[model samples]
Target: MIEQRDVVIIGGGHNGLTAAAYLAQAGLDVQVLERLDVLGGAAISAEAFAGVDARLSRYSYLVSLLPQRIIDDLGLSIELAPRRYSSYTPVPGGDTGLLVDNHDPMATAESFGALDAEDDVVAWAQFYEGTQHLARALFPTVTDPLLTRSEARAAVGDDRLWDALIEQPVGRTIADTFSNDLVRGVVYTDALIGTFAPNDDATLLANRCFLYHVIGGGTGDWNVPVGGMGAVSGELERAARLAGATLTTGAEVVALTTEKTVRWVDATGVEHETSAEHVLVNCSPHELARLLAAGDAGPASTADGAAAPPAEGAQVKVNLLLSRLPRLRDERVDPAAAFGGTFHINETFSQLQRAYDEAAAGQVPGVIPAEIYCHSLTDPSILGPELRASGAHTLTVFALHVPDRLLTEANNEAMRATLQRAVLDSLNSVLAEPIESLLLTDANGQPCVETKTTRDLEHVLRLPGGSIFHGDLAWPWAEDDEPLDTPARRWGVDTGMPGVLLCGSGARRGGAVSGIAGHNAAMAVLESR
Candidate 1:
């Protein structure tokens, strides 16, 4: 006999677990089916390398935008590691550029004094104030989907908010806000994280919103979860289980059976039919389309019409296991900056744009613009004694300018080797220490290695173009205008199909690790039911 449930959640990622937790808390029987043995999905940590405990993969990283209310409501015990201010732009000569909070901003001003001192101080001050204002205005809209544009306008008032919203790209905004080019460049680079857009692109302002919204406040104070980002996912899983939600790992949902009133999902080879009052999909819209297309042809058409098909976009992520901390000329800056701290390698806006141009042209950038962060520096427990002695670190390089489709037809060995060479070469140009001293370890710590190319992420996660944000963060898609709670057919938590809801990043006000999408989706499901 087919098993039945009041609610069936497909994909046991953080969002799925969040939805399940909330639903169960509301007195519903919810079962979550996850393909992997782990529960966090991309937010998971695994000991891909032998000897090492577990590390976060493509989606591994820190999150600050998660509201305090969720933690309090769920009684989550996940503690965020203390965060330090971020440093940016390591100069080639004896000078090292830094940007930190609580410190005298003059230190950074002096570093760039030769470039343009007057411009630096004036611009940095304005940039700081503007981001502060933007954060105050944008945070509420992100946390609550019910916020209306009029409410947002009222909060910031019409003129200033509209000017910040529509006037300039993030890069330009930073430039216009500050007199210092270094400050503008450093602040503006945050907009490029997890995106394929250039700093000059107007869409980057919205991208900045994505980064800023997740920062809790706008100024880039990032915090890692205790243990690892996996901890956050683990806590969500615990919360789900405590709330009476069933989670089945290593059980992939291969297809969905849909009728006008009900849907059944097949997991792996076993067919588990479930009669649910509601079904929540935590996978990407593109993945949902393929699953529905394989089962119900009619709904497949509707899902496709809702969004574009999954295609490779221009972006790539490189995770490296290092034997020791990289040596830099500025030894004063913590080596942890290599992993948990954010650093941008692009020296100028043109260089940053060229990286995107090369990716758009289906080629790798001659000079990659990267945001490098090492998690081991933030969470020392991951480092064994040998690593701790040598200050070994695990570095995640978010490199732009890699063709989104490079993995589609490239040789795996050649691709890996090429990427390794490129990364080392980039570091050699800036770091004072030897690159060879840092040992390389594989996913299993054996002679073998593990890496996720654009194709791997696309095939496994079904992110179109390997775009993690789901869809581009353009104007109409942001703020109170966001489709999160809207009744639209194209976007929003409401899918027009009653009893069915979207909890993925593709939904309105989507992207990042905030889980607002899932929370909003669950609320929508409850209201509709």
Candidate 2:
């Protein structure tokens, strides 16, 4: 039997749900098919340790990309609490470290004053002011019509800002702006959040990642979700379902045709065929191309011998439910204040370069650069009352520059163990006590810490090469003369196919939890009508 709908969404990630909600609200019949039984994809929370009351956000830790407009438009019940501290980086064996207090500028200035960077306080504000200007100009247009590179540059209205952000290497921009190595690393960390680019490299990839990270709501504060990362996708799922959209999980879409015919197998091994007026894809572009190749659809168009950017994901994620917060080595800052925000370890500008170089040479760095955030400190709603009363906290560590190639099927387990130990050792280097001492034991007598490598992300989340951004994030403007006269083509929602639209991170202006791709895809469908 054949089912027909106005729109068929291939994956049920938050972006897919965002598209479904918008289209269904527009009175279009929309159906979302997800291969997994559960939704949210990487933005999910689970009890990793058996018999633990902690609901840890397994992947995709923080939130910065989701816009306020999406919440107001969708009427979502989600609440994002701002982090009191922006970041705290401890200097190993030093008396003090750098701390950027969100509420107090004097404290921030005082922190910088220690580095003899009192001038950086003013420079920091000026630097972010420039990014704020760029955000104001560009973020609003993400869901609207796409702009040409020249048009975007004109919109920016600053030649120097354009030259640094768009034209020149971000490394050059950073070196020119900041004098202190620690402060430089703090700013540069945004550039290499998911990217594997080295600090001295002259690539725009780091610039693009940096732009998206700080462009969040124009403030760039990565607010903590009340319930976890799951809350973001959960709200999106609720919005889509409430808008009269049909959501079907455990239905793997295997093939697609130019006519919008989708073939999938159900959980019960039953095959189903469905046709739609439009098909919105919520996976990577490479995956989309593979699906198209499986059917009557032709080969994906290439540019300069690249169908999609080389997909190599770096970073190792470790989730831990701690019995208590680890004591800080720095006596001035309390444990709560240190881990309340992003706690950086061994991530100096030069250290980041060393880690990248070592990872590029097929070995994890000796002293890995990683950041940790304790979720329970900001929002304890994700934990049970029993766990909360016991002072149990959740920590998510993001280790940078660990290449996926270092992890293979044969050594996946051993590599995860090694990386976990490395991450802990790096953290313990700054902490007064080893993090292992504070780990809560599960029912099976296993430590609460669970680590996920690139291999896990590929096998579990279906992220090709485990790339968090789906692929190298694209600059927010059109690259070629591929006809931006129409809304679909202009916004990069249209896949140059008859009825296919991209609504995932592969789309332009897409990365993190931003709903711009999904919103733009729906707008393309709506405007074309």
Candidate 3:
């Protein structure tokens, strides 16, 4: 029997759930299909340590881009804890570090003075002042229909700021704004997160990535989800289910036709087909191309056209449970405070450039630019009472400039080990001692340390090329000459097809923990009706 519905969403990731919730709540006959047995895709929280009680956000950690509108509209009950400390980057081979405390401007200024970049205290403030302007003028437009490039620029109200951040390479502005290499790197890292771009890339891809990181919620502060990332997705799942969406897990969607027909196999190996008036795909564009069989559903490339380059993620994620927070080499700063916020190591501007060059040359960064943050310090609820009582802490390391091209199917295993060692050595450069020495053992008599490469993320999470944003991020606004006639184009969720729309990270405003893509897709579907 060929069942039919008003809408069918492929993939049960957080984005799919968001779309299902909105469409079903609007009274559409909505059905969602997921390949995994569980919901939450990359946003899941799980007990990473076997027989241990700490639940880690296995893939994506932290939240920034999720807007207040979605939470309020869906009535999601997720709690986000903002850190008082913004970040702390230790000077390589030095006993001092720069700590940005949100609550104490004097203290932060003093830290900058200690680094002898007393001039930057003012430059730092001015730089972020521009970002806040970008945030206020641009953030609200995300939920609304797409705006033209000229409109978005006029909204910023600063021709100089818009020209610097939007028109030019991000590295040029960073160089002009900050004289200190470390401080410039701190600002530059935002551009490189999940993207493999350089300081002077003319494509302005890094500029797009930088805007999303800072414009989130108009404040740009990345917060810790009180109960790990799963709470975010769990609440989303509940909201979707309550909204009358038919959410099915283990229903592997193998094929999607140009006619909006979805074919899937259930857990018991039963095949089923469903057709819908509209289809929402929440997977990577590459995977979408395969499902559509390169059909005339627009280009299946990542974010660009059919000629878009293959997607590749740049970073290595490591999850570790330490018996206690490791001591910092900078005795002036408390280990709690350093680990509480983003802890930077070997991520100086010079280091990052060198790392990018090395990774481009098919090698690991000799001193990998990485960041570490302890979620338990912000919220201990993810750990069991016993584990909390034992003072165990969770440390997640995100090492940058490590691209997907570094790995092959044959060398994945060997490369993972090499990547882990490089990460450990890089992290140890900032610590007083080795982090492995502080690892807690699981019940299986193994150290509680796990490293994830792009290949592993592909195998485990099904992230195409393990690209977190699914592909290169497109501008949130359309060009003045472009047509916004269709509902899909109007919302920036169009997949270049008549019926199938992108409701995942592949969308224009998609990426991070943001539901903008899913929300936009739902609005597009509603507009079409």
Candidate 4:
């Protein structure tokens, strides 16, 4: 007999756990099925190198965008430990780094000034204000479905919001806000992170939304989870279980067996049926589509009648172990700089765009833009005895859009080495000392690039184009025109299939670790029931 449940959530990612937690809190019998042996999905920690402690890989690292509401609502107090000093952008000149103190724009500016007093004060002030305004204006829209053009205009005002939205590429936004090239480069480069778009690309304005989403407290405050991002997931799972949800890790859902409106799940070789009033999908749209296709279970047809296309986008993740903190030319810099913050290295707009172009053309960019973070510096507990004595560190490099074709080429190994070397060389160029002191150098790492590729991401998470955002955040794709709520269908949290809801980053409000999608999906499920 098929075992029955009130709700069976597919995938045990943070979003999935969040959804299950909320549903169970509301008194629903929820069971989470994860394919992996552990929870956290991409927000996971694993031992990449032997003898080293586990670290976040694939989509690893920090996230401040997780809604405060989720934290409080789930009572994740034990699981959530906020680290001080979010991130840093080290200047090439010397040991100077622009430090962000947990969303305090003023502090960030002051820190920048301390590093360089000349023109940095004025430039940082302007940047702080612009990002502050942009962050406030954009934060609400991320978790919500895009507004209609008229609604967007009304909300943002016809004159101001439209102007910024239409004309503000990263280069333009930075130029309009700051005078210093170093500050501008640091701030603007953020808009291009994880995207295939270049700094000058018009789409970068949309990318700015991403920067806004991750900034906690304010424009500059970033937080590392106490143990790594995996801790966030672990806490979410505990909260879910505490709320009466049953979590089954290593139980990969192989198929969705639906009998009319009712759905059942098949995990591994075990078959379990769940008769829930509503079903919430926390996986990527592409993954969901494939799961449904494999089961012959398609999306609810449109009013006019049509199914949505699969999600797509290519991504590559690299994790490195270091023997010591990065040695920069600027020694006067605080040793704390090694922890709790990101260090970005990109000199100009042209350099940024070339990287994107190379990735688009299926070639590794000569100059890789890296967002390097050291967890040990942020979380003292993770500083194993070996690290304390040796000052070791973990670095995750999110190289955007390396073409899949490169992997098929005979020189793929050479290409990977080249890409790795470029990132190391770039960091060394900006630092005072050679990276050799920091190199732990291990060829063996867990969760290969194949796990994060557009194809694999699509296969696993169902994100079209392997795009993590669910839908594009570009001008044409904003608000009402967003793919989540197209004229033919509504894939956002509320408007999808009556009993089906969306909680992934790709939902209406778009990407990030924020629980907006899950919260919204849960509310929708509760309200419908």
Candidate 5:
């Protein structure tokens, strides 16, 4: 028998759940189908290693892009705790490191002054001041309808800020502003996170990544979720259920048609057909193209008749269960304060470019430039009593420039082992003790340094090409030829098919843990009605 629903969400990830919650709140009957037995998708937590007794944010760690407005509207109980520090980067062969203390600017300035980049202290503040203004004018527009580029310029209200961030390359801005190599890397990291773009490149891909990273909640601070990343999706799931939405796990949608008919199989392998008035997709754009193949409809082409930008993920996620924090090679900084925020290793400006050059030449960086964060330092709620009492911690290391092309099916395991060794070696270079010595052993006595290579993410999370942003991030403003009047087209959530919309990171202004895509998708459905 064919079932009827007002809305059918294709995936049960956080974005999908967000869309379902909003639509159901609007009095629409929404049903969400998830392929996995559990929800949250990549934004999930797990007792990854045996005998660890710790809930690790297996993937998609931390939160920033999720706005408070979405929380209040959904009446969610998710809490994002601010970190005392923003970032700490160890200087080579030095007792001091660059620490950006969130609560103490004097200390941060002192750190910058030690670097002999005294001018950067002022430049750093001015840079963020511009971003703050940009965020004020732009962040609110994310959930609202999209604006043309000219309208966006007017909204930002600062020609110099817009020209530096939007018109010119982010690398140029960083290079011209910051003189120190380390400081340049720190500022440029915002643009390069999860992106494969080089610093000297002219592409605006890095600019889009930078804009999104800095514009989170208008302050651009990435906060730690109090109870692992699962807490985020859990709240969204709760909101959806409270609003009378139906969510089914282990129900993978296998087929779809342009008429809003979806065919999926449940855990029992029993296939069912359902029809909805509207369908919201929370998967990658490529995945959506495959789902709609039966209907002969696909994503719209750009004005230049080019296919959508290539979406290739460029990161290697290493999740470590440490028995204790490794002492820093730099004697001046405490381990807790350093690891509480992003701890950078081997990520200087030239080194980042070198890593990109190596990857471009089909080789991995010898000294992997990665960032690490310890969630337990700020919020230990994600840990069980046993792990917490033992002072065990979870360290999530995200290494950059490892594109999907490097991890082939034939050599995935071998390459992963090699990369893990390289990561440990890199960490040991900056630490007083070898990181491997502090690793927690599971019941089988296996080292608890688990790694998710680009291929692993591709297989496990279904992030096509393992791209975390789902697809290449689009510019927040309207393109030159994009329709000005079409709400769906302008908003970038429109799938271009009747009764179809996007509610995932692939959508415009979508990335990180932000629910803007889902919120926009629901708005599109409501406005259509």
Candidate 6:
């Protein structure tokens, strides 16, 4: 039997849910299909370790780009908690580290003074002031209609600030603006979060990544959701359901047609067909191309009939359940304070650049630059009362410069182990004791540390090459002289097909947990109607 809907959304990730909620609320019949039994995509929470009651955010964590407008519009009940300490970076092999305290300016300044970087105290403030300016000018426009490059630049209003952040390579800006190597590394990490580019990358891919990180919500603060990432997605699920959007999980979409007919197989191996007036895709651009190629009536080329190679991601995610936070070698800073915010390990300015060089040369860096944060410290609700009382916590370590090209199918496991050891070795360098000492045993008497490689993510989620942002991040605005002839093009959701639109990271301005792509796609459909 063939069912019909006004709009059929593929892949019920958070973005798909956002579109479903909006369209359904507007009295359109919407249906969302998801392959997994549960939704949320990368934004999910699970009890990763057996016998561990702590629910760790398994993949993508933190909330920064999610607009408060979306939350209010969808009637979501999500709470974002703030961490007072911005970050703590130990001076490798030294007895002291730099800590940025959000609430205590005097302390943060003193930490810089300890490093003889008293000059950076003013430079750091001035640098962020510029980012805040960009954030204010650009953030409110994310969900609105597309802005041309000239329009965006004029909106920015300052040529010097625009040139520093937008026109030139981000590495040059970091090198010229900040004096201290540690401070420069801290600033540069934002550019390399999910991107695999060097500081002097001529392509300026790092600049685009840095733009999204800083312009989020006009405030540039990454907050922790109260009950882990699942709570955030759960609210979206509730919103979609309440809006009368039909959600069918465990349905794998295998084919899509130019006629807006979607084909999928249900959990029991049942093939079902559905027709829609509009088809909104919530998958990667690369995955969308693969689906079109699978369809009999679909084109053999990319979504827009342009070639789009599979995107390669460059990070390794390792989740750990520890009995307690590990002690730090820096006696000046409290362990609670250091772990509460981002914990930088072996990620100095020169170290990060050299790591990229080594990774590009076909070798994992000897010292992997990694960042760790303790979610339980900010939102204890993710942990069971017993575990909270027992002083147990969750540590999520995201290591950089481990590109997907580094691992092959035959050597994925071996390489994952190697990367894991390198990550821990970097962490252990700043710790008073080995991080393994705090590891909690699971029910099977195994240490509760799980490392996810690129290949593992490809097998689990159809993230081609395990690219978390789906592919390279796109600039938020339209280039000058670009055509906006259709609703898809104007809204930045074009999929080349006439009635299909992209609603995921592939969409312009799409990345992170932000639902801008979904919102834009829905608007495009609504406008067409």
RMSD of each: 3.5, 1.8, 1.6, 4.8, 1.9, 1.2
TM per model? 0.88, 0.96, 0.98, 0.81, 0.97, 0.98
Error of 5 at 147 (Å): 1.5
Candidate ranking (TM-score, best to worst):
6, 3, 5, 2, 1, 4
Q: After superposition, how far is residue 315 of candidate 6 from its true place, in Å?
A: 0.2
Q: Write the per-residue lDDT of candidate 2 for residues 1-529, one digit (tens) a residue.
A: 7899999999999899999999999999999999999888888888889998888888887888787788888998988889999899987667678888989989989988877778778988899888888888887767668888888888889999989877887877887899888788888898887789988667689999988987787677798889998998999999999999999999998988767899999999999999999899898877877777777865554221124644878989998898889888788888898888999998888888888999999998999999998899999998999999999999999999998889888999999999999999998899888888898899999999889888898888778677898888888888656578766677787677766788888788888987888888998988887
- Model 3 residue pairs with clashes: none
Put down candidate 5 lDDT per residue, 1-529, tens digits, no spaces: 9999999999999999999999999999999999999998898889899876888888988888897889999999988999999999987556668999989999999999988978899999999899989888888888888887888999988899899989999898899989999999988888988899898768789999999998988888889988899999999999999999999999978877878899999999999999999988888877777676644445352121112544688999899988889999777888999998999988889989999999988998877888998999988988889889998988999988888888889999999998888887877888888888899899898999899988898788788878998877888878656774655665678766767778888888888888888898888888888
* Greater-TM-score candidate between 3 and 4: 3
Using TM-score as the measure, the top candidate is 6
Residues 211-322, model 1: lDDT tens digits: 4543363443567776777788888899889999989887767666565222333344655656677778887777666666666654445442234656334455666677
How well does candidate 4 match the true structure in TM-score terms? 0.81
Q: Which stretches of candidate 5 lie over 4 Å from their true place?
A: 294-310
Question: Model 4 over residues 39-59: C-alpha lDDT tens digits?
Answer: 877677666566555454446
- Give the alpha carbon lDDT tens digit for every residue of 30-81 in model 3: 9999999999889999999899999999888899989999999999999999
| Candidate 5: worst-modelled 10 consecutive residues by lDDT | 301-310
**Runs in model 6 with CA error above 4 Å?**
297-307
10 residues in a row with least lDDT, candidate 6: 298-307
